[model samples]
Target chain A: MDTATKPQQIRLSTTPSRADLEALKIGDIVYLDGLIYTAREGVYKKVIEEGADLPLDLPAESAVNFHCSPAATVNPDGSFNMGAVTATASFRFSKWIGPWIERSGARIIIGKGGMTSKDYREHFVPNGAVYLTTVGYGTGALLGRGIKQVKAVHWNKELGLAQAMWVIEAANMGPFIVDGDLAGNSLFERENARIAANLDKVYEGTRPAVLRRFGETDDRTDEVIG
Target chain B: MIAIETIQETAERLMEKAAIEIPEDYLDGLRTMANTEDGDLSSFVLQAMLENYEAAKQDRRAMCGDTGCPRWYVKMGNEARIEGGPIALEAALRRATAKSTNEIPLRPNRVHPLWRTDHDNNVGIGAPEIEYGFEPDGEWIDLVTVHKGGLFGTDYRMLFPSDGVEGIKRFFLDSLVAFGKRGLACQPAIIGIGLGGSKDTCMVLGKRAACLRTVGSRNSDARIAAMEDEFKALGNSIGMGAMGFVGKSMVVDCNIEVGYCHTGGMQMSVHAFCLSSRRAVARIHGDGRVEYRTDPDWFTDYQRRESVEWTPPQSLSKSA
Candidate 1:
């Protein structure tokens, strides 16, 4: 139950309310809810390359996506148990993100890791999709919020605990921010810019590009703000 | 000195010691992980362990209700001779069996062979094993007590190949398949993979090591580290974050121990600790005097409550 909407077909800001967007800027917080279908690296790669069957079939306009895989818990009947964890990230499969979101109706990508692209701005914001990030290693607390229901449409598997397709109905599951907003800006983008600018000075030209942005903060730095 | 006793007495003593000692290890390991992870979840696990320990101490109860019957491993000292004890392993262990079942804790598990609920540990004839170490490590009667945590309904595992480049491609699919069945019992886990062991050994080794003293430590090898990095990344890539929520870093550190063999056989053991990671360990001496270990107050406090996250140390030591 989804309808295709191209990025150009929709115009919205990071914050949900129209008035809230009127006074928004970078570093602001936002929350998204409502029918977000599920997909992971398997589904993303398939839609991009293989055109394989998908777990859900939903629209992208204002829809959200998740990057999580939860573990198991004690079953109700005292039998077996497992977690409905989130997917990881939406970036590594960057090649297909734009095309698929354009085709499907998903507009937000919820993940924990990092994703980067050269034409990210034009590809994401101009197309009405924004990138969101959830707290890492906070599955138990997130699930403690209590799920309303689980939708199986567009669900995907093949990534295991690290990746699974689950349509979870979550309320107030947040403190997550728009790492990438509708205007082609993101934490990945800004970090890449700073890295590019400081490459010769800070990294000494010998640092592995992969070493940037991952556990690179000074020891005296703050303990995870927000 | 007390008069010489029969073989049953020796096994009985050993069995008694195992029950107490094994729980100590479980408790201490949880504390160690709590000490290092410093995350909100680890804190809760640590807290529960401490509470279990305290509950046992306050009333001299078993560290935990389960006190999973010990896995008895023995080795005959080169010069040591046992004239009075029961020769067979099982017979000897039964004498030392606990008559005290003070609220024996029940785990969310079932018997594998029969696929039925058997909580008492007394149901099966050879419920646990009596493997002997071949090494002549001395007559010191080294009773290596293993704490068994997989209780069936809660711990389901499978060993599959490391998915190629698509990054956790196969595992994600399998998990989805599992989700389709809605058969998993816990949320948030610490996955341990033992690569290269002969099928059963690989899984057993990984799981056993996972329950080893170094619960919070990273994998010891580099190649395995690479796999962990990928799994974490791939899991993150696929949005397998939070406890089933659209978050990040769902599977904590996937601890894998590698064993080399002439032929290739890989085994991956997945034991879901649930959000609770309910486990404890105790080590008992010949006299049945037990020495206990586990995370301190703050860590233990966090282990019980989901909202708690304490700052754990980078290195692990008993001092914690």
Candidate 2:
């Protein structure tokens, strides 16, 4: 490991100020404090598409929305047991993210893979939001340890445990890498560009398959996500 | 005879082990990658993962929140007999799966594909698939459970004989590069390639190659073993590491498995056992002795034999 090039780390609240977000670079690391909530396609469709009322106050109470489903269960006694908490891939939620950010006032979106730069520029920049990708696409046990409490759960009966909204209080909860900044700069995109430069050399001996599938791209620069 | 109650009890234990413990082979592989990885952000990710595994074990928690879809591979010696038979054995496995899901608090990941009905347990229609294999030996059974991530990092392609090894390499790179972007396929993974079989078997072979085999294990055939070594190097050389960052740690290891296919066509499938490569194995003897270990050792010489007739190895025959 290169100690000299290690990224800087900071502690920030879930409901962070615009200045706090603006100061963060794409490669910096962050650990979160305050309240965060879990939401994904199920929550998005129910609230945004079906027009369900917001269950909790938005940025006033919490501004971090995690694209995650924890290894959790509701016990017979009605207490929640959340074992490990990790984020899901955020790019899959691209369709709902714009509206979600607008309605929920989410200042920090934590997830597995960061969304595309286009998404960051369009949805996050205008809203003063940034993206934090979970380390290892997880660090679930470490993140789980940081959970001060499972504050509440919503829509368990309607959507089940995996899709229901889960409110949690975090205390230094992360090892999250800043994938998108307030300026819409993306760490993944920068890394991709540098890695792309070596593709031709690495693929020198391999030949393309004779039977190519439809919608396949020969261009190495193109991303798989839409 | 192996008792049904014993089977279920052992299976439940296996589930917990698979979820919480980072197998030694995979941990060692990642440790090696972490030491050599120079990409700053990627190195940080690797170090955190190392800590995460320790935390999981110490806290007795699942390593990843996405605990993945639990499945089973049962290999029984031909002389073995169960208390109730195959039906009872299956029920025991399913019962163990559901019981562990709640006890371990695994994210009930399985649901009806269309209806989206979640049982709140990992068990559902065709969920926690159980596959069977047999060996011509003693009265003990080996149970292997793998909680592999269900989504992403696997693909199948069909190529004619004319396509050759270069074509195979192309498809392999395509899968890695495509899913490797932003670490969707979760690189620094155990990349498994199934070279031949019908399409469905190709997928099965590839999946087994990833989940059942340990890191540094090779295919029995010399040519295929060589390809395994080469592919591991090729994947690491892609200039990508954990989370698709710029580093040379994309592949921890590569494993290849092959099956006989149609003469004119070659079917191929690729699978990645991710950073949390969760698998556990146990052997339960008829006398009630149960031993636990990480290695599945599923692909024995008999499992890969090409001969039309069964012939005991000289050593085994002499011992008998």
Going through the candidates in order, their DockQ values are 0.02, 0.82
**TM-score for candidate 2:** 0.98
**CA shift at A60, candidate 2, in angstroms?**
0.9
In model 2, residue pairs whose N, Cα or C atoms come closer than 3 Å (at least 3 residues apart or on different chains), thus clashing, are B188-B250
Candidate topping lDDT: 2
True contacts kept of each: 0.01, 0.84
For candidate 1 chain B, which ten residues in a row score worst on lDDT?
B295-304
Q: RMSD to the native, candidate 1?
A: 16.6
Top model by DockQ, which number?
Answer: 2
TM-score of chain B of each: 0.54, 0.98
Supply candidate 2's per-residue lDDT for B229.
96
Give per-residue CA lDDT, model 2, range B1-320, as digits (tens): 98999999999999999999999999999999999998887888899999999999999999999999999999998898999999999999999999999998788999899989988898989988999998888799999999998377899999878888888988898889889888888768999898788999999999999999999898878999999999999999899999999988888999999999999899999999999999999999979899999999998888887899988766653112
lDDT of each: 0.39, 0.91
- The residue-by-residue lDDT of candidate 1 on A1-226, one tens digit each, is 1122101112233224424333333333344445444566556666667776544555523366665433322234533232223234344566667777676656666664334534346566556666665432223333323334554433222332223455555555443444566556655334333323322332121212221344544321111211
